[model samples]
Target: MAVKLNTPIKLVLFDVDGVMTDGTIYMAESGEFCKAFNVKDGLAIELLRAHEIKSGVISGKASPALTNRCQKLGFDIIETGCKHKLPKLEQICTNFNVTADAIAFCGDDVLDLPIMERCGLSVAPADAHQLVLEQADWVSAYKGGSGMVRDFVDTLLLSQSNIGLKEIYQPLLRKIALDDLTGVEQ
Candidate 1:
């Protein structure tokens, strides 16, 4: 179901593990951690930025992979190693000068409940925990790490009478020739 926000969305927050990486953690023999990220999700963050809507992460766990990905995505706010999300969310609201009613938060587990309750919009992935799904104002058809973020962004923008992926991304193809295409360096 589509959720029309009472306030315009100024900021969008996401929980990292389940919401961003399908709740998977890969640990190397040397004790390093690796997490896979969807490029489409990165593009979704960019889409929010293009529309002057800030995006951020508030996650309990910390890892180098998550750090690098958030940087590459150019997130407006990044709060990792955060055990209690509600307080951090409050601080983020204060720091960003945005009220809770103007925020949209996507989460996938129980830890996300408090913040979800406070934000103007609460979104969850299709495969999210039942509790989270119940709390969500809107749910994506895609599961976490599988274009869930993209679906959320698409719906949010569309609800605002704003442009979607084709309008924002299709022009890039015209700007760069296929012959010049190369894999992303990062």
Candidate 2:
């Protein structure tokens, strides 16, 4: 069954490696690490914040970069180094004063299954593992860290007819070429 995006969504939870960084862990020669994040996804998160939707990140790995990124994104909850995610999910729900029916959880790996099953809506990236894709209520056409989160944000905002987003994006839409407007290159 398709999860409806028109409803008021209270919380949005994301998985770090795959959903935020294309699932790659890059280590430099000097042991400094880095991960690529999509600018569009960053902007989408900001939009979600503007609409008063609470956002968070839950990652199995603990990295300084991830922490820094989460801080920069203004995420309300950051759960890192969590191998088992169910407890973290429960804690976040309690902390937010929301139920499973009001939250959306996006994940891309088997480790994210338990929470995904419990969320109101479950999302997966296009390149997510088979199990995760199967469990997701929606699988984004765009891959993680490559505009998948942006796609999800757009879907939610458009489906809800969010006035703020409409006011911002509608003007830009009019300026784009028709092919670009449809996101299809001719």
Q: What's each prediction's TM-score? A: 0.89, 0.84
Q: Model 1 Cα displacement at 163 (Å)?
A: 5.4
Best by TM-score: 1
Off by over 4 Å in 2: 1-7, 162-165, 168-186
Best by lDDT: 1
Error of 2 at 69 (Å): 0.6
lDDT per residue as tens, model 2, 1-186: 234853478899999888977888899898877888888898778778766788999889888888989898889999999999999888887877898878889999999999999988899999999999999989999898889898888777666664665675654454345648679532
Specify the poorest-scoring 10-residue window by lDDT in model 1: 170-179
List runs of model 1 lying over 4 Å from the truth.
162-165, 168-186
Alpha-carbon RMSD, each predicted model: 3.3, 7.1
lDDT of 2: 0.83
